[model samples]
Target: MIKLMRIDYRLIHGQVAMAWTSAIGANCLLVANDAVSKDSMRITTLKLARPAGCKLVIKSVEDSITALNSGVTDPYNLFIIVESVEDAYRLAKGYRNIRSINFGGAKPQKDCTRKLSVTTPVSERDMQLLKELVNEGIEIEIRQVPGDEKINVSKLL
Candidate 1:
C-alpha cells in the first residue's frame, strides 16, 4: 500500500534516507520524476543514497501511477516522492489512493512570490496547484524531515 507521498526536490537524499524510511515504515521508495527517470547518472546517484534495506523505483509520473494502480508495487509498503507541485498535482489527479502530501524541500524559484517554509518556496502557480489539491481532499503539509513539525500548507498560503 502507498504509505506516504512526499514532494522533495532532492528525492531520496540523506535526510529522507535516514528519517522517512523508518518513520513511515516503508520498504519501497518510488521517485516519480520524468527527468530523473530518463537520466542514468541521477538514477545511479539516487540508488546509492537510498536506505540499505529499502528498494527504489524511479519512473516517470505516468508510469508510476500505472504501477501503483495496477498493483505492481503492492508487495511492499511504498513511499512516493515527486519533485514539483505540478508533478504532485498530476499524481493526485491520477492516483485516488494518495491521502497526504508532504512538501519537503522546494527551492525558491526565480519566480517564487512567497516562502512557505525555510526550504519551501512557492510561486503563484505552485499555490494554485496546491489549492486545487487541497480541494480534492488531499492533505498537504510542509515538513523538511520526519522530525520537523508539520505545517499545514493551507496556513502558509
Candidate 2:
C-alpha cells in the first residue's frame, strides 16, 4: 500500500526519515529516480540517512511501477518519493493508484519563471505539467512537512 507520494528534491533527508515516515506509518521508503538508482555513493548515502526500522528501495520510475504493479511491494506501507514534477507525472501516469502528490521542495532552476513556494521555483514547462496533472484528477498539495497546513496548488496557479 502506498501511504504517500511526495516530490522533494532532497529525497531521503531528516524531515522525510523522521517526520513523514512516522506521520504516514510507512515502513518502506521507495525512491523512484533514474540517477539515484545508478549511483552507488548516492544510494549508500540515502541508505545511511534512512531511519532505522524503515527499508529503503531505490529504483528507476519504470522499475518502481513494475514492482508496484506486480505486487512486489504489497506487504509494506510504502512511501514513494520522486525528485521532480516530471518524474512525479511519469509515476502517476503509469500507476493509477497514485491519486495525490505532496510537493515538498523544488530548488530554483536557472530557467525558473515562477515561484510556487519559498522552496519551489517552477519553469513554464513545470507549470504546464502540474496543471495537467491536476486536470487529470491528481490532487496537488504544497507543504513542507506533514504537520504543516496543505496549500492547494490549484489556488496557487
Candidate 3:
C-alpha cells in the first residue's frame, strides 16, 4: 500500500531520508523520475541519502505506474517521490492508490512572474494541474517536513 506521494525537487535528503520516512513508517522509497533514473550519479546519491533499512527503487514514471498498478508494490509500504507537478499528476491520475500529495520543495522558476496563491513559485501550468488534482478529491499540502503544519492546496486555490 502507498504511504505517501511527495513532490520535491530534491528527491532524497536529510528531511525525507529521516523525518518523512519515519513519520509514514515507509519501508520502500520509490523514486519515479525519468531523468534521475537515467543518471548514474543521481541514482547513487539518492541511494546514499535513503534511510537505512529501507529499499530504494528508482524507475521511470511509466515503469513506476506499471509496478504500482500491477500490485507488485502491494507487499511493501511505499513512499513515492516525484520531482514535478506533471509527474505527480500522471501518477495520481494513473493510479487511484495515490490519495494525497505533499509539495515539499519547489525551486523558483526564474522567468515566472504570475503570482500564485502559495508562498513559493510555480508555473501557471503546474498551478492548473494542482488545482485539477484538488478538484479530483486528492488532498494536496505544502510543508518541508512532517513536523511542519500542512497548508492545504485547496485553501490557497
Candidate 4:
C-alpha cells in the first residue's frame, strides 16, 4: 500500500533520500516518471543516490498504477514519487479514493510561475487543471517534507 504520494521534480535528490523518506518512514520508493523510467542511467543514478537498505522501483505512471492496484499487499511502507503535477494528474486518472498529494519541487523554467515554495512557474492551463483536480476531491499541498508547513492549493490559487 502507498503510505505517501510525493510530487518532486528531483525524484531522488538528497532531501528526498534523507528527509522525506525518513519523515514518512517509507521502506520502498516508487518513482513514476516517463523520462526516468525509460532511461537506465537516470534510474541507476537514483538508486545510487538512495541511502542503503532502501528498496526503490522506477516505473512509468502506467506501471505504477498496475503495481499500486495489484493487491500484492506490501508490508513495507511505500512512497509514490512523481515529477510534475500533470504526471500526478495522469496517474490519478483511473485510481479511486486518493485524498491528498504533496508538491515537493518543480524547479524553475521559462514562463513558469512560483506556484509553491519549491516549485517554479506553472502554466495557466496547469493551474486550471490542478484546480479542477482538487475540485474533484484531490487535495494539493506545497511542502518540501512531511513536517514542513504545508501551503494549501486553494489559498495559493
Candidate 5:
C-alpha cells in the first residue's frame, strides 16, 4: 500500500528519513527516479541517509511502476519519492494506486517564476501538469514536512 508520494529534490534526507516515514507509518521508501537509480554515488548516499529499520528501494520510474502494478509492493506500507513534478505525474499516471502527492522540496528551475511552498518552486510547465493532475482528481498537497499543514495545490493553482 502507498501511504504517500512526494516530490523532494533532495530525495532522502532528515525530514523524509524520520518525520514523514514515521508519520505515515511506512516501512518502505521507494525512490522512483531515472537518474538516481543509475548513479552509484547517489545510491550510496541515499542508503546512508535511509531511516533505521526502514526498507529502501531505488528503481527507475518505469520499474517502479511495474513493481507497483504487479503487486510486489503490496506487502509493505510504501512511501514513494520522486525528484520532480514531472516524475510524480509519470508514476501517478502509470499506477492507479497513487491518489495523492506531496510537494516536499524542489530546486529552482531556470524558468520557474512561482512557488508552491518555500521549499518548492514551480515553473509554467510544472503549473500546467499540476492543474492536469488536479483535474484527474489527484490530491496535491504542499508542505516542507509532515508537521506543516497541507496547503492544497488545486486551490492555489
Candidate 6:
C-alpha cells in the first residue's frame, strides 16, 4: 500500500532517505520509472542509498502497479517515487485512489517555471493531463521534504 506518490527526478536522495521517509514511516519504496528499472547499476545505487531496514523495489510503471496492487487487503504504507510529471500522470492513470502528489525535485530545463528551486516545464499535452488529474480531485504540492513548507499548486492556479 502506497501512502504517498512523490515525483522526484533525483529519486532516493539524502532528503528523501533522511527526512521524508523517516517522517512518513515508509518502510517500502516502489520506484516506478522505466529508465531506472532498465539500468541495474542505477537501481543498485538507489537501493544502497536507502536505509538498511527499508526495502526498495525499482520497477517500471506497469510492474509497480501489478506488484503493489496484487493481494493488498490491509493497505500497508509505501512510497512511490517517480521521475517526471508525465510519469506521475501515467502512474495515476494506471493506479487508482491517488490523491496529493509531491514534487520533490526536477532538474532545471529550458522553458521551465521555477517553484521552490524545482523546475517544472510542462508541455501542452502534459498541462492538459495535469489539469485532468486536478479535475479528478488530485492534490498537487511542491515540497522538497516533510519539514519543508509546502507550496500548493492549486493556490497558484
The list of candidate 1 runs beyond 4 A from truth reads: none
Model 2 lDDT on a 0 to 1 scale: 0.93
What tens digits encode model 6's per-residue C-alpha lDDT throughout 1-157? 6667898888898888878888888888889998999998998899789876887788898887776567452355688899888889888887776788987776555655434343555555556666777888998888877877888766654
Q: TM-score of every model?
A: 0.96, 0.98, 0.94, 0.90, 0.97, 0.87
lDDT of 5 by residue, 11-125 (tens): 9989999899999999999999999999999999999999999999999999999999999999999999999999999998999778899999888888998987778889998
Q: Candidate 3 lDDT (Cα, whole model)?
A: 0.88
Cα-based lDDT for every prediction = 0.90, 0.93, 0.88, 0.78, 0.93, 0.77
Clash count, one per candidate:
0, 0, 0, 3, 0, 0
Q: How far out, in Å, is residue 85 in model 5?
A: 0.3
Model 5 ranges off by over 4 Å: none
Residue by residue across 1-157, what tens digits does model 2's lDDT show?
9999999999999889999999999999999999999999999999899989999999999999999999999999999999998899999888888889999999679999998889889889989999999998889999888989999998888
Task: Report the error of model 4 at residue 30, Å.
Answer: 0.3
The number of residue pairs in model 4 that clash at the backbone is: 3
The better candidate by TM-score, 1 or 5, is 5
Residue range 1-157, candidate 4, lDDT tens digits: 6677877888888888888888788888889988889998998899899767789888888887777777552676887889888888877774554577888777576667555454645767668778888888888888876677888887777
- Give the C-alpha miss distance for residue 102 in model 4, angstroms: 0.7
Candidate 2 displacement at residue 37 in angstroms: 0.5
lDDT of 6: 0.77
Q: What value of lDDT does candidate 1 attain over all alpha carbons? A: 0.90
Cand. 4 Cα-lDDT: 0.78
Off by over 4 Å in 6: 72-75, 111-121
